[model samples]
Target chain A: MTPEELAEFRRRQKSRNWVLGGLLVFFAVLFYAITIVRMGD
Target chain B: MTTAAPITKQALPTDWRDFYALTKPRVMSLVIFTGLCGLLAAPGSINPVLGFTAILCIALGAGGAGALNQWLESDLDAGMKRTQKRPIPAGRMDPTNARDFGIALSVLSVCLMGIAIGWLAASILLVSILYYAIIYTMWLKPRTPQNIVIGGAAGAFPPMIGWVAVTGDITLMPVLLFAIIFMWTPPHFWALALFIKSDYAKVGIPMMPVVRGQASTRRQIMVYSVLLVPIAAAPWFIGGTGAIYGIISIALSLAFLALSVPVATRISEDGDAMKPEKRLFAFSILYLFALFAALVVDRVAAYQGFAL
Candidate 1:
């Protein structure tokens, strides 16, 4: 592949990683909130 | 303009979907369901968050074991038609990657379970993973015809683990739940084996029908099916469950036995149809789902102060 295609591939991969990382953080926060609510009851 | 060079195509990149498939999500669903039923049926209540954590640990542990199984059995899986397209066997993922992913998930789930719930549940989860990955996948599967008989215990542990997560103890009820699944596995697996005997033979996996003749395998399936009826009813007899579960268990077990009768009795020649075996295989899945659903329902009814 050309250098341009290689650069594009890396860009796309980084974006995918960011999305997945964000989703993980979202779930971690959600779970923590739920736990706090249950513990407070 | 300069002439463009011809571009070569490369293999598609492995995505999260391939990793998900390695976990055998379909199988994990049943494991989660049974584990949740065990949690729900236990005597006392747990915090919802902890309850969810126990079930999540069960799922992750089951997934880890599944990934490890696929990693170890990639060669045999490639040989079998049913499992040939799995991520490892299909060249979608590296075997080492699958193994590492499995181990990571297994360790993470156990640690989280210990921290969030109790160590007993985490320990049982750890054992279930090792039992499936090492004992069943590595040892019994290639060596013995009775692999499913003993290996079924790995699948049976989830509910007991869930119960322990709640009570932090093992009791007769959880053991009875474990026994029901343990007794049910042979008939369920053997029926599938009877129909797909060629796959096991091709892979050199010593499944019952491959190691023993079909006649013997069928007889054993019937024997287990017969035994499962009484074993399934034990929870009700012991006052762990109510009559609703008892009645459903009897009906389901009888249906399972009736389905097994033709498979056991009839002699199918080479090139003969395997309708009975196929039916039993299909019904066996339904039988377990229905039986466990009834258990949950019975518990819910009891919780609502209805005598059943």
Candidate 2:
């Protein structure tokens, strides 16, 4: 592959990773919130 | 431009960890959580060692059932994109080895529970395994969409087993806990099905979405979600729990209902359009964990003689 194609592949992979990372972060915060509420104060 | 070649050789994972993945760890977390609730809520005291042993046995039994489930569904797993990477399907572990491992663990766990705890607990554990491995995985999964609804009994048994381990008797409290988990399974599963409908379709499984279509599936999810709120709150209404638990129960149920109503009521031409099911799927995990945690915490308050 050319340098340009290699760079494009990396960029696409990074974007996919970012999307998954964002989802994990979102669910983690939601779980933590529920734990606090259930823990009471 | 160079095109990618399809690889013919599959590298198998030789590590023991690959075998462990056969048991669904995520589902077992809920089982352990509810089992702990059962142990905490019983009227009498249990030796801490014995109590821990019972919980361990329950986890092992649950895991064993999961392993057997994977063994039976290996072909189906291979077809589904989401599950195609499981150990058996991925060719990391042999299917027969998984079957043997599951059977061995199932017997060992049941025997240990019986000797260390009580026969009642052991019996419940055995039945739970049978219900999942034979009744649900083998019978119901390939047959109908109502599989989860009826087969959810296997998931619901942990608390009752825990209760029996401690009190050595069945009562309304444990049954109510069973009911809570039982009712929670449908919406929880259906929400997941909505997102992964293609996987189920590919494998020829009649999940709610694959068999009944999205609108009917959404309606069923809402119906279960609405039904679950009252069932979850039953402990407080019947005086099994206190004010604090009652408040949290109602609050969690309300949030769950709020999440489900939009999915059920949404109007769209595309079958896979609604994102609310995904939202509900994520929140449902939190909802069950909080509901049970509230029960556990409320019990602690009561024991300490505090008006919670």
Candidate closest to the true structure, highest DockQ: 1
Instruction: Give stretches of model 1 more than 4 Å off.
Output: A2-19, A34-41, B1-12
lDDT of 2 by residue, B1-308 (tens): 01111222122223455556876888899999889888887778877667877898999899899999998988888887788888777776667789998998799789878877888899999999999999999999889999999898899999889888889999888999999989999999988888888888887888988898988988998999889888988988889888878899999999999999998987446566557878899999999888988988888888888746
lDDT of 1 by residue, B246-304 (tens): 99999999999999999999878888788898999999999988899999899999988
lDDT of 2: 0.83
TM-score of chain B of each: 0.95, 0.93
Question: In model 1 chain B, which range of ten residues has the least summed lDDT?
Answer: B1-10
lDDT for B60 (candidate 2): 88
Model 1 TM-score on a 0 to 1 scale: 0.91
| Candidate 2 Cα RMSD after full superposition onto the native fold (Å) | 10.7
Interface RMSD of each: 4.2, 13.2
**Considering only N, C-alpha and C atoms within 3 Å, which residue pairs clash in candidate 1?**
none
Worst 10 residues of 2 chain B by lDDT: B1-10
The DockQ assigned to candidate 1 is 0.27
| DockQ score of each predicted structure, in the order shown | 0.27, 0.02
TM-score of each: 0.91, 0.83
What is the number of backbone collisions in each predicted candidate, taken in the order shown?
0, 0
